[model samples]
Target: MSDTRPTPIRPRPRNDARVVTEAAELGTVLGIWAHPDDEAFLSAGLMAAARDAGNRVVCVTATLGEHGTDDPRHWPPERLAAVRGHEVAASLAALGVSEHHILGITDGTCAEQPPDGVVRRLARIVSDVAPDTIVTFGPDGFTGHEDHQTVSRWATAARATAAPRARLLYATTTAEFAGWWEPTRHTFPVFLTDELPLRTPRSALAVELSLDDARLDRKMVALRAQATQITGLIAALGEERAREWWSSETFVAAEYAESRSSWATWQVAA
Candidate 1:
């Protein structure tokens, strides 16, 4: 097959947000995430918009999120894994994303896996995709999930090792989102953590997309597809609040991520 690599991503003008409805701003996009609903909660709309724009959008999920529950008795690992695998398919379909990779790393075990092996495998995928933009988690891992952290490290190293020219972005909450969700911070945990999350202020955001009515509806549908994971949270937060919670997608560029001294290092080789 002929190489279809896109042009490297250039810096966008400050204070200007790319209309998600437009194509080429993000180029062919590759998303690397930790669990089944990570992509849905973070970048589903972005992925769908890119696909609609005719860009190649590939998704890589690290685990099935088998332990993503409050009741292990009713939701055992094996059973949850099977169900989540199917749910992810439906979820991705709702977003119009057809290319997906499920790296079968066991749930809750990524931090223990040998980094070199994981990075090598991810590097292979990066080399194959040749995406102009790569999106994943930052240092805080969104909700400080160990799996999210490990995946972030692997994805970053892989990008450095195999596709350094690609633009890198980390999914992050904006200050607005932090404020909007502050009231229920303890009542409703969006991801795996109960701690206050790190946010990227609006001024520093590279790409922030507030889904329009149509896109927000699509995102809700995609998120709802993972009923086993999101149903209860939606019920507790109420539909409107739940919708408002994820209606916007925010990401910071690699330079911003690197600027944080605590999250500074990027592995040069797998």
Candidate 2:
């Protein structure tokens, strides 16, 4: 018998605010990301919303963000890692998330880590936490950052090995947002030209969370908690634009199938 399984079609992006509400019903939720501020930048609203609804929200960061600072006179690389570690914890706390884990991988060097080792560590974390929902960067890394891409791969691998049934989502932006935001270079010093335009097709997006004022307030607090990295962002975007950008969050659902090997191969749900 020739293998014949119908390929799953990608779902069109809809205003699925209900998904966020449903996620709160899930017992455990995990947000995995590359560096200290990633959770704040991408998923703080969702994290805060989920936590407020009484779900156990956990965040896992892959690196200490040692290379994040442009000013060595103030933050040397060795000390920057520890500083960022504390910052991320504070960020999560601001979102009402009390559980967090750091993989201790070197900042700016995630792509250099042994793939299997990285996957294994993440798998262990997933197994221990057993989240019902897992969120991470899409392939674009939201900014084309190598660490973002590497962590995305690792998170997918870990999900397959440790929590195949978990609902997997990739943080993303709509093409409309990309076109409007990319050309204006609204993300300047924080996100450079080469790093951006990481938007996904609207047709592929799965969820959109329209944050309420309270959730937006928490998100702002979380972002401010990462002061070392976001000072430039606040200065550049100004308070109004920054609030506009942070008012909503979006994600694309990812689908995966078990391969001939023990692992799973992931693709956009389209």
Candidate 3:
């Protein structure tokens, strides 16, 4: 499977500390993820900030999240997929993102598809979007789900093949947050803590964005829109703890051809 992964056209060292604080430097930003609510949980604040800063924001979800139902007995896979799709749209809307693409891959089975097919599909979107920065899950997938891992690989490969010059960023959480959330993992019907690949070391983090009150408020709205997924999250972490956990977004610079100084201009609102 490693043989099928697309090698970076211009590989460079992963840790580049230069922070991005300006939207102009970021230009158009694209976020790719495996499931519907992923953007909301992982990068909604960042997306909203970019959009508010007048940068074009686009999102691509690889699956409808059919398997994410906490009440499968009532929702089932098909019904849950439909619901999640609508939820994702509303969430993105709250973040001021109107452009999005759905790949329609089967839920919980993204890794089963041929790697080439996934790469091709994402590559086409990247080519069309032509974004300055591309964001997606890192190798750990943040949750350690096979689908998440698969999407991470596909997105990275797509960037390599179709948008080598674009700056690639991976959504991640700090080790401290992982520790705080670890004990509460079992509260969720899905995505157990033990199963999740949480926590990117602080050393690997290249950029950290702290959301302001208004941005955090918007993030909460986007998160609440995914009622099905958030019911347990809110109950487990409580509103305040959950907010604390989500207040900051972190990323590791994966690949880029631009100079560190140019990337440093992109900023996240503090």
Candidate 4:
């Protein structure tokens, strides 16, 4: 039902000098995200849990999310980009991920970029890291955002070239999460199309995370670090709802989706 990797040990101080166990048991985790806060919203718990278990976690942001705002006059691209750079650094730091790369791709334009060039650049990172696991959006882009879909395409190509053995997990919603999201979905019109967001069943998720208080609190900290992005949502939903909303995370394995009927097996797994 779920992936074979186990959750890493938790709660030790970041300064713990104890020698870590063989990281290869789960191996290095690489997250390639379209924007800064996407990582926090979709996979913070998973990444934090991996780090707690002593895995090396690396983050890659394709863009600075410069165009993510209601008022461009107040938040121009250059200014927003600078702010998001700091926000992403602080956000990743909160999850114990110090190694990060920003590809400097302009926000909201990934679909317009040359695919071969982008794929080559991503392939270089894959070659360098040799990650055991790669996490990113699915073909749906998790919200049907064009930039996200482009990044997913590039990551898929890169992984096939450089880390074919690595597990590729795409952020996914569960049926329960989809039902839970109804009331709050209006507060955040993230989905670009009516057919967006393929939801997996809980039993079939490659990874399903329901964070404990400590981890959930830590995840909240990471989200809060991206204030420019998530502050309004938190305020609109109220802190309690915001916390409850993100308390869970889930994913689907790309291998199974390709080998079988896409998401059909997961639907039956329930």
What Cα-based lDDT does every candidate model obtain?
A: 0.80, 0.75, 0.76, 0.78
lDDT of 2 by residue, 8-124 (tens): 335543554344444465558898998899999888988887888888888899888887765776888788887888888889998889898888888777877899988988898
The predicted structure with the larger lDDT, 2 or 4, is 4
Candidate 1 structure quality by residue, lDDT tens digits, 90-195: 9999989989999998888888799999899999999999999999998667776778877988999999999999989888776677778778766665445433
Instruction: Indicate the residue-level lDDT of 228 in model 1.
Output: 97
**Residue 250 in candidate 1, Cα distance off native in Å:** 0.7
The global Cα lDDT (0 to 1) of model 1 is 0.80
Q: Which candidate has the top score in lDDT? A: 1
Q: Candidate 1: minimum summed lDDT over ten consecutive residues — where?
A: 261-270
Off by over 4 Å in 2: 1-9, 12-27, 186-196, 256-270
RMSD for each model, in Å, please? 8.1, 6.9, 8.2, 9.4
Every model's TM-score: 0.86, 0.83, 0.83, 0.84
> CA shift at 66, candidate 4, in angstroms?
0.4
* Candidate numbers, best lDDT first, in rank order: 1, 4, 3, 2
Range of the 10 consecutive residues with the lowest summed lDDT in candidate 3: 261-270
Instruction: List candidate 1 stretches off by more than 4 Å.
Output: 1-24, 190-195, 258-270
Estimate candidate 3's alpha-carbon lDDT, on a 0 to 1 scale.
0.76
**What's the TM for model 4?**
0.84
Please report how far candidate 2 places residue 212 from its true position, in Å.
1.0
Model 2 lDDT on a 0 to 1 scale:
0.75
